[model samples]
Target chain A: MAKGSLRINEISNAANVLLNVIFILLSFLCIYPILLVIGTSFAEETYLNVVGYKAFPKVISLDAYKYVLSNAKPITNAYIVTIITTLTGTVLSTLMIALYAYAIVQQGFKYRRFFTFFIFFTMLFNGGIVPWYIVCTQVLKIQNTLIALVWPYLINAWYVMVMKTFYNTTVPSAIIEAAKIDGASELKTFFRIVFPIAIPGLATIALFMTLRYWNDWYLPFMLTSDPKLSNIQMYLKRILNNLQELLNSSSAAMQAGSMLAVVPREGARMAICALAVGPIVLAYPFFQRFFVKGLTIGSVKG
Target chain B: MVKTVVKQLKDKAIEIKKKKSFFKDLHDNREYLLMIVPGVLQLILFNYLPLFGLILAFKTVDYSKGFFNMDWNGFKNFEFLFKNPDVFTVLRNTLGYNLIFIVTGAIVPVAVAVGLSLLKNKTGARAYQSFMFLPYFLSWIIVSYLVFGIFDYRLGIFNNIISGVFGREAVNWYQSPRYWPTILVLLHIWKTFGYNSIIYFAAIMGIDSELYEAASIDGAGVWKQVLVITIPSIKPVIVMLAILAVGKILNADFGMFYNVPMGSGALMPVTNVLDTFVYNALKINGDIAMATAAGFFQSVVGFVLVLVTNHIVNRIDSAQALF
Candidate 1:
């Protein structure tokens, strides 16, 4: 028996070592591409052309960063648009989802089934892309407007369902009952008691909405052709689609004649990407902890 | 005659009371009703309103004449969609890629989750998990840049490695359709497997520790423990997620198909799924009817798949079914 247990231990130890190596390699695969992009972003264009995209910079240069910042009009405009849209969309969507979710969960609320079904039906079927595009552009007439960015993602039914589940599990019923006994109104009870207790849930949904709004390029791509309304993602997409458009069309960048001649085309694109991806990567730890919790809550059998 | 009139009056009074209570229920929950109105309105505007516009699939739309003024045309757009040779390629690519994704997606995540669960060093496991999840946060546009950095013909790291490290001729990755299937699948797995693993990880975490303890006492090694306990314990979650993925088999991730390849015409033969096909038809070619027809086909088939899969799941395990 002692000999058999010793053999088991040896096998288990070997398995553990193997898993560690595999996981470490897997982790490297995940992060190496990101490092490559960052390294290329800082590399001198001439050296980059010669060396290709090294995991580390061959010769460090700030010309790409310099060009991007010096031609800051479009980038800044995109940042402002993205920031405003993300904030507005996150806040409004969270509140709307919370309110809608809270209402449906109320035991005494009439039309609860009707209201729940109204949103849930959307998950099962959609009008597809073309009709959605037509409705946004022609029917609502939100083309080239800020509303076009903020409105489409305003109430994701999946998020609403998640928020509803969060509320069901997180919020205690006794406090609401007591508040009702004291003659507090439904909205007042929710705003004061439920909302305070449900902060974590609200934060989770808000993070999701923030990410959704930040990463939205499809809306601008489909609904609006106007450059003035482009968010950061859409701006990046436009540059990605046609690199020459930004380099040549931005007259200011072109007027900086000597720099334009050395305009690290590949490096500049990577720099733009690095800049766009920087914040989210930095905040990923925070997002990951909450998102894991949110996903589990959402996945729970209701 | 008097008795009959009295019975009629009684029925009328009951009807009036029922009508009043219906309004009373509405009045009682007035605040709750008010709260959900905005969400309901949004649902109607974005979701349901577009359903009406689906008729455009069957119509010859003329914007100059306005939306409602379009003439009815039956089967023309769909015929055009089917008559095009590209439809078969798109359908095959979409279905084939999705089939590969569903299988690998389930297996890889489950393995990762199990591996993480088994690690004796808690901090190392956590760190590894975090690193894996990094790719999920990135927008596909950013990922495209990463792909470009690796695959860019002259200067990409892929060529650098092949020619410089391996002493082989560098291949133009974008221009080659044959290499794209593997490239795209690898990219899809890289971007998602980490995020997907989280769900399975959480499930594994929830499994009873006593099961492992008992199995170990029986002289079962790590592999046996996993096969006997871990896999069976998490089988429901694995099945549930797989079914959900199968339901979405017809709908490819648009961002992945569209942005990742950077619009390489050569790669389209392998990369052009239904979503991108519809997008190109609508945006690039300005063939609204063709795009709408394809979109309509996808939606109908997709809806049916969801319903059918949900039915199968319900039959096997109602708790796991997505109702």
Candidate 2:
């Protein structure tokens, strides 16, 4: 077993080829589901009603999209709500988290440990949804408002901690000291000097914030009472679950029987799925670079 | 190191106080302290305040009187969960699905990371990664529809494939409980393995290439090198991920259990866990007390499990212990 051999190299090369084939097959499997949804969404709803969705469509139609777009008001409204919330939420969450993270990392700050524990404690225990719902509705009076969509997610404990670790390790002390030597205010140093250098880390957190706000339906579903304020994901879930459209079939037998009776909804469901996933797919490559850099630096966020 | 730094920090503060005015040091850092105000305030309002609402778990809310006037009924609130008729089914599904996820969660990521690492072409690896990462970027709502698209019995791709291949009737996937556990596991793996693999892939990348070189020089075959080199190189990351996963074993992802099954009453046997059950109860009755009880039950059980797990991990290996 001591001699380095040509035969083993040949075998390894062959094995690499086999592995490549397996991964390509696996990659195709991953790509195919999303394609099926996209293809079916464009396919005539009747074709799926006859034979279901296909990996590749036999016929093409835009009826599902047309049906969805016909309800253009709600879709546009939800999209607007999602867009506003995503933009506002990511910016605010990233800023506040970076600020807090930077504050805690400074050795001169006396309460850093206490503040760290204060934020960290919330991660370990939560009051669950009922009370959270109560506070948001009863005390804060956020329900049925646009604010409800963005308010709850403004700061996540995990992201705050990640940014804290990022600042602690990456933003060197020498930079802050150099700025202080010039009589720069703490705020001045942070904004003018430190924040620029920390953009990569901030962008990483921003990517997470953007995705969460874009994809979140839970916050809206629980916090907001107004359908006008509902996000797109909730709208999709509503369509998927609202079996009441299956006629006056309140009975269990009829409900189950009538599930297939709601055939058009299947195509509509895929259309909505595609609609919801569309923006994320378009925007992901921009965030793709930050993902590897951020995750590698602070991989514990999960 | 954290303690040593804190100790030195206190010593410096004391010496600085003796040399200068106390207000000077406090004045120096007040801006930094001010920076933290919004974060602390938001956290207290959102995260910690709800912790105070955990008291509702012990109370029967009387909306006429508000939260302050709610009746303290002792453990009577917990009766909602422990006394529910579906208690066994809900517990079974939550624990069962979570266990399956834990096992798959450990194995699938490592497998993907190893497989991806073996690729020679960076472009192809990146493309494959993009495909895998695609599903993770999508929300559960979209994922549910994507899954339903394939399993829609009458019009689903799976039924058509089987029927076309086997000349058999399409199975009604939604109504049938027999296939869900497998389907759910497969979906769980599919949605997650891509993201999880990246963590292990990063760890694998960090392993010394020299070890692999040494192994190849010793005439190790690909399989042997992978066994002795790649897997062992990523062992710590694998163990860390597994330990963290075990901490969350009692808690199921609500979106997956709720949305992905389309919340079919027929499939609830296999799908309804504590989160969805509590959600349904709250949705129907608006009974804050009962809902809090369920929530509290999940949190308490999950908390205890985490503690026990961390303790065991601490005993075995202190560095990997979460605390």
Interface RMSD of each: 5.2, 4.9
Best by TM-score: 1
Q: What is the lDDT of candidate 2?
A: 0.78
Q: Candidate 2's residue-wise lDDT over B135-222, tens digit each?
A: 7888888888778878987777888888977889989888988889998899888888888888777777777766777777998867
The residue ranges of model 1 lying beyond 4 angstroms of the native Cα positions read A1-11, A255-261, B1-15, B64-69
Which pairs clash in the backbone of model 1?
Answer: none
What's model 1's lDDT at B68?
Answer: 87
DockQ per candidate: 0.52, 0.42
As a whole number from 0 to 100, the lDDT of residue A122 in candidate 2 is 74
**Candidate No. with top lDDT:** 1
- Residue pairs in collision within model 2: A52-B155
Q: Which stretches of candidate 2 lie over 4 Å from their true place?
A: A1-11, A243-268, A300-302, B1-26, B214-222
All models, RMSD in angstroms:
3.3, 7.0
